[model samples]
Target: MDGETALDALQNLTSAAGTNYSIDKNSDLGDMYFNMTNYVGDTLKMMCMMRSHHMLTDVVLQAGSEQFHAHKLVLASASPYFKAMFTGGLKECDMSHVKLQGVCPTTLARILQFMYTGIIRVTEVTVCQLLPAATMFQVPDIINACCVFLERQLDPSNVIGIANFAEQHGCKELHEKANQFIEQHFTQICQEEEFFQLSAMQLVALVKKDALNVQDEQDVYQAVLQWVKYDEENRRPKMEHILQAVRCQYLTPAFLSKQMKSCDLLKKLPQCRKYLAQIFKDMTLHKKPCVKERTPNTPRVIYIAGGYLRYSLDILEAFNADDKTWTQLAKLTVPRSGLGGAFLKGMFYAVGGRNNAPGSSYDSDWVDRYHPVLDQWRPCSPMTTPRNRVGVAVMDGYLYAVGGSSGSDYHSSVERYEPDEDRWTLVRPMQYKRLGVGVAVVNRMLYAMGGYDGINRLNSAESYHPENDEWTPISPMHVARSGAGVATLNNCVYVVGGYDGSKQLNSVECYDTEKDTWEFRAPIRISRSALSLTVLDGKLYAMGGYDGTSFLSIVEVYDPTKDVWEEGEPLTSGRSGHASAVSFHQCVIHCDQHEHSLSTESSLGWCSTRPSSTLSALAGSALNGAVPEPRTSGVGAVSNSLSAPGRGLPDGSGPSLPYGP
Candidate 1:
């Protein structure tokens, strides 16, 4: 008891018999009092039902034509609003019926049901109608519950309505939740008609985030254009304002050539033309489009392992092709020269390189894994044969180490490393004992391409079927390239520049997997052998290699869309004979400098001009294993571009409630 209550009790006892008698302390009295209250609750429930059976109805909540007969005490106890009106000297206390405003009778019935049963079926159809009534009655618990139900129903189709409704009614939690959902799914959500329904200020706020989950400002362009096209007569006045937010410099050239060049909206808005001019000027100066970052998914990363610069070194590095930056990773356990690597299930496996020390079996069979999360390498079982210059590819959940040299011995033997089993088994040997062969995965099969069979540079290529445990011969390339780099893009295997026995080669050939034929495309801008190749951001990359006499730090990118290859930002430190694999991370470091630079103005801002964008979507960026469908006339599927940040939630309410926000 509080001090005031104790003092009052003493005063009351002063006049009682035996004033000095001690008081009895009963901790178990709580359960007794609870039982007594339960009896009172049962009586109250009985009274609440008396009016239902037409026994003694003192109050009626008149909802529409239906009159709900109820006792004043039950109604007052259940709702504070009812308590104020019925017992607080209001005329309604004496009245037979009280009509509720701004809420349907059915909704009121549901509220009453919750008061009695402590549960209500919350549905999308009813939550909207129920929230306002719950708020009016000061039912914060019910308000919080209904808000949660509304949040789970949020999607591209209804989030805008929910956001606006929640804000207007002061449902702060719901408003915050819906707005957060919009930001995380801006790319896909903006494509929805519901997103276009946002007020001018709301849309502006959403489009102006440095960390928007879109690839570039061009996505912002497409989103704004679609919104304008919904109702050009009304939206045209805001065109310049909206388009001004879009950074034209970040748009693909295909969009510039086919769509922006023919835009009627651009001609009408001179300010938008200025935006385009700035992009062109920047490009002329070779300044990359200043986007703060990509958000739709974890950015695809390039992991480089084992290369030769002045000397062979066991160096590990990561190249983010998008931002054109590089990060040095954990070095191999032992220095390995010409070791091959592959990214499998979120880890980098560096295998089969010549040990830094000179000796027999200097071709170390040891295999070590670089866990990106742990930021360190741990040893796994070694290969069946000690070899260097092996080409590693993942197929059917196993890493296939293709042809490479063991000391002076050229190996046609191919082996598969099973991650789950932590074991390596020799697969069917290749048809040819070739050293320095390149391997890539295309169409679910492992293709081992050009290499030296010790006697001569071999143009012959073979495909390994993991299911059958066999190698099937495929058509040969037009030229021989030992120590070549290989990649699969657009359903074809591309063999880049390599040694042709006579000299370093510059010609590039793409093999049609379906046709089983090799066709020449454009040659590399520079002739290099022993380079690393991988596809990133829907473009082919040939990076860091020796071009006959000198080690090259050159970075070349090929756009199959434009049928050309231009220079990209070079690696921070380039070395030849490096093994390259497509790993994944949040963003690529800019290759030119290690600086984390992003443009503020052009990156993200309110759109105040007509945006320039192609009506068609481009092929979505690649994911783990498969290439996406070609981009046609509109934006493609939700690319694996942005990933959300980590946050913790409260217990039992599920992952979404207090966390994963």
Candidate 2:
């Protein structure tokens, strides 16, 4: 043979025999490996050719009016549906022809090609048909491919349709992506015809989500009216039930009044009119709405509200840990200092404190609930007695407002707020009257620490069991403290910086709820009283308060593991007697009000201003599993935007007895 021809023959012979072997160099390990580099590719290519030419074909898949010739072995190997049909004693096991009832012929052909070639083209035009067939045939990879294609094609015009499609086919990832898209673009989506086509249940589901992104609650109210007005004769009955989805309590009294007078449908439906009237009455009476419910992927924020600046200020601000910056939100309903604050359910309640707004100089019995998503404030059923420098804690879904001064006398009385009833009932009183008390709940028991009891700053502590409504004394702290910040962590209640009858104290102590014993921990760097304590990311944060000389803007973080204190980002302004609570809120970071792309991967730290047509590049990057690290500034980043800090709620009240003035 010629030299070139002989070499070619030899190489072909070696490749065909599959004798490519590699040996391990380690003498201790006796191992050898042979790899056929293109074996899988070659086999799949040969099978594809055979199926296309109908050579050695074992089965015919009939979908609609077309037939696809494919090998039983290849089809069964690639699809669980075919595997069960051929091997699970089904009649189709012996049959040469199989009929797929609901699958389309075009979709079947593509699926069969994918079974042999491991490739399928999915696009907007083909995905609608392809996904259902792939789902029926139990082809998860192709189904996922179709879903990914649909997700990219989502927008206000088509998201509702896509969400319905995903829901019907039980595609969970696609459904959630579409639902989140709906939430981010509710105002625009409601204007679309597809939103009008939604059934009552679907409409209610969309409107009631706390994550529904709207600049104002009025948008939701208007949308509901539009939906009902679309087909008044048929939909008017569903109005009362659907109106409940709209947070009418948050709607402006003027807006509600305008709707009641202007809308013909609302007037026609007696039940709808009554519901709106009750909501208006409650709004006027200052009875707040129930606490909001937070969804998954919401951002956790630290809210500091109602502190004394020069006088009692109604300032409300949120600290974003990801950016280490603060954004001023809506002000408190009443300007008050020495307030008690806690997050019950998903709402932040600014409990009893003194309203030091110049002429108004009395302690407040008012309980205002802050809506984190709306950045709005509304009053709830007020406490039985007005209080200042009160202690607050949440236990078993009820908000406890503990002892404080009533502008006349120090009180040991405690009241429990029931959100469902929108009323505060007096619970068991404490053994000692405590003003400026520190309260914490652990192991289903509420613990009240040191405070002033009419005369002296007390060091005594007590625990209350809500089951029997009684208080039992616990071990006392080493130092007498009043206005101390209290927080719970690792089964221990921590008490930080407070006044000890003489001077601002920097001492810190932790009481083990299990052991009922007190032990000292690392003290704060700044000696201050009326500072707010909150736990986040397993660390204790002591926020702004006042020292003996001046109001301090210091923030100290305590680490239990190292037992040390470190300086953190300070507050925007110095304030004392402010209330703080840590909560998971859906934080909307505004960036010039631009739109961005939709990303299905919702994470905690990332912030986007608009849900649609914004962050397009970041969305794709996240889909590819290479999510960029979160930042405070970028193309579409979370900027340090500040709103005005002095907005107050309008005055209105239906009755004065329990709802407060």
Candidate 3:
């Protein structure tokens, strides 16, 4: 009784004293909290001194014949395998030396270094070996670093190898990434050696996945035949199973007969033969064939819309840049010239223009929009003003039909079209009325520059800010221009040749929107009006205009960096007053007067000429010599693309043409 009472009394006294001290006293533990990272880092840095330090090392890691003196605790903490071995009372943990027979000494060193200092250097070449070792050692950080290194180097040739490696190692994330890469590049992977190296079961599993992103059945068939040929005797037995994975129904009869039918692999496969017969039957029955996948993201088809050649016209067509061929599309509702065109949301807005038939000229307010997917034109809301010779521009998701004219009257009234609303709203009028205006967007502001004001061709330039619906007069261009072509590139708005009241001017001017300044750049080689100026691949293209003599079908391209113009691909047929715009490729719409004509084909063709230039490639020919024709430039300077010897039709499926239609 006495002992228990004494212990309770002691405990109660201590508790009361502690409570009083906390309530009655003020204390400062520290003013600022400090990090111990530097101290800890320095201590770890000393531990990583592999060549000099051996004091606390408890074990030797022997990879190959080389040995690394390391601490058990450090290795154990970094790897589950090492942790289990060291802490689970394994017999190897008691040994002074641990031998890793399958590991490379260099990779083991790098892995240990990473475990100690959180740093490792891995490359695509070295990671191939290092990844396996890291996986074996159960070192996740080194494994992750090696995986990342391999992924960055993944390409058509090596992606399959990496994917196979990732799958073998049970790396779920890496396997998923490799699968995606394989899908995106399946066509190219067919050309890789590793693709042919995959086993029959692996190939079947791979190709049979509905997620295979092959452009055509041909690609899959090619891959299968190549794989089978690598060891025909063994793979031949499984040909029927593998051919089932090939979407032979997606292949055309011609492809099946010409490419696949001749192959022994396809001839022997009963499943493939049945699929081909069904495909031919579907073709004969006029059933909708597989919608061939288009080239990804790149618009291989250039849509050609209305323009005047011999009357106000309403013809529409699309030119295939890939195959260098043209196919006519649905016609527009109205025959119009001076087409106000802009591309938005995969549709071409054919805005206001002037109607031309037998003896009459009428201003047209009809807005027919072309939908590529539907291959048809539907009427959108007409502009507030009926204008011909108008300038069309897109800025901030709005279509702007700037200054043009209503019959003989010039217009300064600016109308903005919103696609979502299917309506046009009048914006601030320009400072000067203009017809045949060259309008472009720079820095999200609509710039209306060169145009005629009925009595005088205007050089006065103004900028329209959409945010405030305000028009501010900027510096006037160096020359008065009307019926000129305008384009924007590399942050500058360029105005090319136009009639300057008295003469057809060839002078080119550039306006820097950021600097709010205008400077006369290099003049184009030829003087022409009613031409088109466009930017493709960061370069300016000027084509097809009246040279105060006759209409031109010649095309020219300007190198802004070099301040010079060179000849581009000449249009198959000469045209003027035409409208052209850049898509994934450049397109030109014929717009000549009712009485004049190209005297030949009605279709517009495309070339694969890249518009960008290497300023260092100063060896370009000028083609500045004048031609015999009144409107033709000597060199046929500006147009979209001209990939000589490699020009294909728009379909991209046909054999390449010889630089001509």
RMSD of each: 21.2, 14.5, 24.2
Candidate 2 wrongly placed segments (more than 4 Å): 1-125, 128-148, 152-297, 585-661
**What is each predicted model's overall lDDT from 0 to 1?**
0.67, 0.76, 0.66
What is candidate 2's CA lDDT for residue 143? 89
In terms of lDDT, the poorest run of 10 residues in model 2 is 648-657
Model 3: residue 304 alpha-carbon error in angstroms: 4.5
Error of 3 at 428 (Å): 1.5
lDDT of 1 by residue, 1-661 (tens): 6545544554454445232333445676733322232444444454544444655667778878877777777677778888999889989978987887888889988887667556678775677678888989877778888888777666555666777778877999889877766665576777655666666666677777554655345668888878777777788788777765665555644455445477776676777767776666554443434653333344557888877654456677776655666777656666655678887655788877654322211456777777654456777777888766778887545788887766557789999888878999998999998767888876457899988776788899998765567788999888977777788886688998888766777789898887889999888899878788888867898987777666778989999988798998787675676778775432223333453422111212223442122110110110221222322221111112212211111100001111111
Residue range with the least summed lDDT across 10 consecutive positions in model 1: 646-655
Q: Write the per-residue lDDT of candidate 2 for residues 544-655, one digit (tens) a residue.
A: 8878667768999999999999999999998888899987544443223441212232333223443333222212211122322322111111112212222211100000
Runs in model 3 deviating more than 4 A are 1-297, 300-304, 317-328, 585-661
Give the winner by lDDT: 1 or 2: 2
lDDT (Cα) of model 1: 0.67
TM-score of 1: 0.49
Each candidate's clash count = 30, 9, 22
Ranking by TM-score: 2, 1, 3
